[model samples]
Target: MSGPITLRTQKALVTRYKNSLATAIVQGASVLANEESPKMLAIEATALRETAALVEKALENFTKTADGMEEITEEQDKQIQAYVEEVQAVVANAETLLIRIGAKRTGLQEATPMDEGRRPTVTKKTIVELPEIPIPTFDGKITDSENFWALFDASVHSQDLTGLQKFNYLLKALKGSAREAIKRYPITEANYAAAVELLHSKFGDKDKLIRSLQTRKETASARNSQLTEQRRLLDYLFALVTQLEQNGIVLNGSFVAQKILAKFQPDLQRRLLKQRVVQGNSEELWAVKQLLTDLDTLIKTEEQVSEMLPENEAFRGGTKGRPPPRRYETTSGQRSQMRQNLCIYCSDTEHNSLRCPKVDSARNRREFLKEHKLCINCGKPNHISRECLRSGCTLCDGDKHHFSLCPKRLPTALSSAGPTKSAYTKSSRTTQQPKRADAKQPTSSAKTGAHCINSENK
Candidate 1:
């Protein structure tokens, strides 16, 4: 009784409170109403007072029971909080009705004399006004049904309100398809229950909820390779598994562990394996729970490595002055086209054949482009070099060729194409004609000394 309560026990307590309140409301409906005769109203007043006292006692006991339980798992804590909020709403609504009934009974007693009694005396009781509880709305999402219905039931459905009143509240609280579904049922007192049943049948199906959770589980394991993604994936899986288990769907630990590992990148999968989550050489069983710890450690280590890289030059050994290359950009339409065509050289989807790293060297790339009958200027098919409209050879400002395969940037460029020009070209657009060689040639002594200095420096 002092320790943490089991889920079964908590559910039973909520069920008991709901059943009791429902029975009380149903049995005392006539007496709880405002249109009773003075004598009958006196009898009804006694019943209403007894019912109110019982409700107040029940609420106090419910609160004490919750407070007595020790703190446990996060899921348990959430359930407890939901239970408290739900029950509090129900009790507050019930108390509001009870106070109204009491006021009506008091007015009846003062207005109408009781049989063989002097003019009835009214005993005033202090009433504490309750703050309005905001009701949650539903937008036809299956995932939202659980939360939406819990608050809906506590504040509206199970309250002392009439069916027509509840129906109005229901209509106000729904939107999208949820409202449309209930709109078919006219807002009559009789149709309220039917509308509630219809919504519960459609969106509140237990099987649908379980399937949705399963779909999310599968998605969590699909290509979530980055540290941030993996961390979020693990946390999501933990909550997902907890929810599935709560619904009596137990997953196979080994199967789930293997499935998740198989979906990771090969290097990441190997690192996880090295953590000894999977034991035995041939018939290994995966410890699914241990995966969370290993994955967390891997994420932390990766973040640490990334943080240290900028500060430690030895760890980031690459070009010193040049910045890293910018990632290739493509519009959505271009990406769609690329997906259809792929890289003509290596069949890669991310880039065109001209940008393929596999077709190394300017000579090979140009050969591939020519052999495929693609435009040498832009590397796209269907047009000749001159006919192609794209500007050409950004590397050397040469005409009729792409910068990607420009011979100027290639060290092994063919000698027939002449010595590779300086990668640094003049920014000026004006063409300067070659100067006539009117000056005398340099002295043989000066040329020899310059050549000697260059050779010695090398």
Candidate 2:
């Protein structure tokens, strides 16, 4: 009922049956050898031997019908049967060997059931899902290397990655000097471990790192920027100290505190030192955290105070709002002395108005008034004597005589220089003594007599 099988078709069938028998033999032996239970191992061996027989029969039928011939001679048939029997014997021997080794049949060896009249379906291979791992990067710096190695080691231990996968991840993370060191090595599982070991050797010098950390000191001055920088340096040192201590180095906390305190300014150092003595607290005595808090507060207070006060001109050797003292040259080529009694009210050089004795005394008041040629009558400054409002003498308060002619006041020689009375009054007044016209009367004697008469009238 079926068309004759072509040579190509027959060959394909033979190859397919041979591959199926090979696969069953390999899988069965693997499972049987690995199985612990004797019963399971026997079961798998029996299934494997049966599958091998079916494969052998299929191969025999194809070989007999080779070259498109429907029938094979007795010799050809016997040969095909002999070959199939030999394969069966080999499968049986393999099963016996597996059983001898105490192999048990496992679920892995369980064969799928086939349809009676349908070809066996080929199953596709299943894809396995792997967990994601974060990669680490390194720049060859000691700090970066420390961080990277820590994370890399953790990742390797946590993830279910093969050696080759780990190597690839390590290579991906390499950069700068680190990348160059391992660049020549082949990308392989063995090389990955070696590269990692090499990196550890190159960058993992604990003593060198400790020495470097010991040398680090805060280089910044005491300021806002310096505070930021100092804090960063101190933090770095602390991290380094922790790392060294973990690696079995015994670092004293007090020693570390002393080292940190050495970085501050001299004034800050003195202050902190004083505080330490006063508090007597041994803990965190020179710790940067506490010192930084104090320093920050100090600097902030200083800034606020500075903002409130004017600049220190004294420090600059000058006074604000005042000019240099004026130097006056005298006629004798000597410097004039500075005026001491500069009056605040009247601006006089002779006396200060505050302590001026003439201010309250009526008799001495006219001295100041006369200096400015002011009227003594009304007490107003800047007016002449003739413009005076008072009709009385300034010295004696007499209404009949002017201040210049008052008898109570002493007369200078200049007061007698001019005649007190007019020549007409002198000539008309009755006198007991008469004088010749040629012999002139002394004007001084006549003026004196006239002053006497005037004083008597007042």
Candidate 3:
């Protein structure tokens, strides 16, 4: 940082490095401070401390990436987003739910007493019992999910449990709120495991549950383990989105955006989607659509999550390309003072690069001879200049009318084929907006179906 005014003179730089005078001054100060070298004249000292400002600027190029989230609204879409948020909230214990006791949840909070009010009428088919099968059967087994017959027959609706109680308890035992904390960023497996231990507080000692689950049924335990892993993946997605909000200018943020492969869209939870359908027959379906519109609006303050590892499965061996060149205009005086003999790429004052005709034509015949390349028209490699191809080559045989060995910039054949279903994927998968069409006459949209998990069946 230290330098004298005299060292920055323009004359000292023009003959040598064509560097910044400020740099020369700083180097002069450094040499005098060290005192290891002998004394020198002002001109001699200035010549030694030369460097390019252009090179310094070129070395500092940092690029930014954009977040690429899709937006959609369908009956099933709202359900999935809400379900994801609910899962996060539940796991974070940001909100609490009255839940039922299961294997590890031996300690239970008694169900809050209820005052009878308007309630659904109990019927025979509504109740069913979950048999204590030594092995929990997903299909034919009498399980909690299938216990409608026994539950209603006994006039027993599990008062303490939320709709998510069945699968969440398993997750709660394995995951806890730690998974939700990562909704804003990615978490390592070690962190996820620790979060699981933190979440199993009231449920009981988690180590014991893990031991029990392992000791009791070794085979089914693997399937059960897979479920927790899936939930962790969901958390990782949230983390990815959160990081984007802190960085890139992503297009949009919604549950539909994360689950690009419709496989993860949570279609089974579309209770609201069905409700929207029935209510489309009535008025106010429009209001229902608004709910989803707002839910997708949880976009963070920042955008662009490009720094995060790309989630695209198509990414091949990881090698990002170098950034483009950097150019800044110099003032008229500086431009005038610029070297007339310098090359365009390297501004050294030997020979101007732009006027270096040797790089282009027959003027550099010796270069072509040395490389052993001849013109493509005349059967050659090194001498076939790019300019020759632009003029159109005679090597027109197959589809490659030009360079036979040249590859395409695009990857897939379909990329250039105009439109496809992918363009509408985001819109088709989000909240199923309530019938926004005037109640006076139902529109084609209402008739098709809404994605609301609240009402409409579609």
Q: What TM-score, over all chains together, does every model reach?
A: 0.37, 0.33, 0.13
Per-model clash counts, in order, read 0, 4, 54
Cα error, residue 118 of model 3, in Å, equals: 65
C-alpha RMSD for every candidate = 23.7, 40.2, 37.7
lDDT of 3 by residue, 59-125 (tens): 1110000011233347544543353344333232311211111211221111211345523343222
Cα misplacement distance, residue 218 of candidate 2 (Å) = 7.4
Off by over 4 Å in 1: 1-134, 221-225, 264-268, 277-458
lDDT pick, better of 1 and 3: 1
Per-residue lDDT, model 2, residue 32, is: 49
**Cα lDDT of model 1 by residue, 165-267, tens digit:** 5766787689889977864554456878899999999888999999998898787763323444555676777787777777888665567778866655565
Worst 10 residues of 2 by lDDT: 312-321
Flag regions of model 3 displaced more than 4 Å: 1-226, 251-261, 265-458
Greater lDDT among 2 and 3 belongs to 2
Score each candidate by Cα lDDT.
0.61, 0.52, 0.30
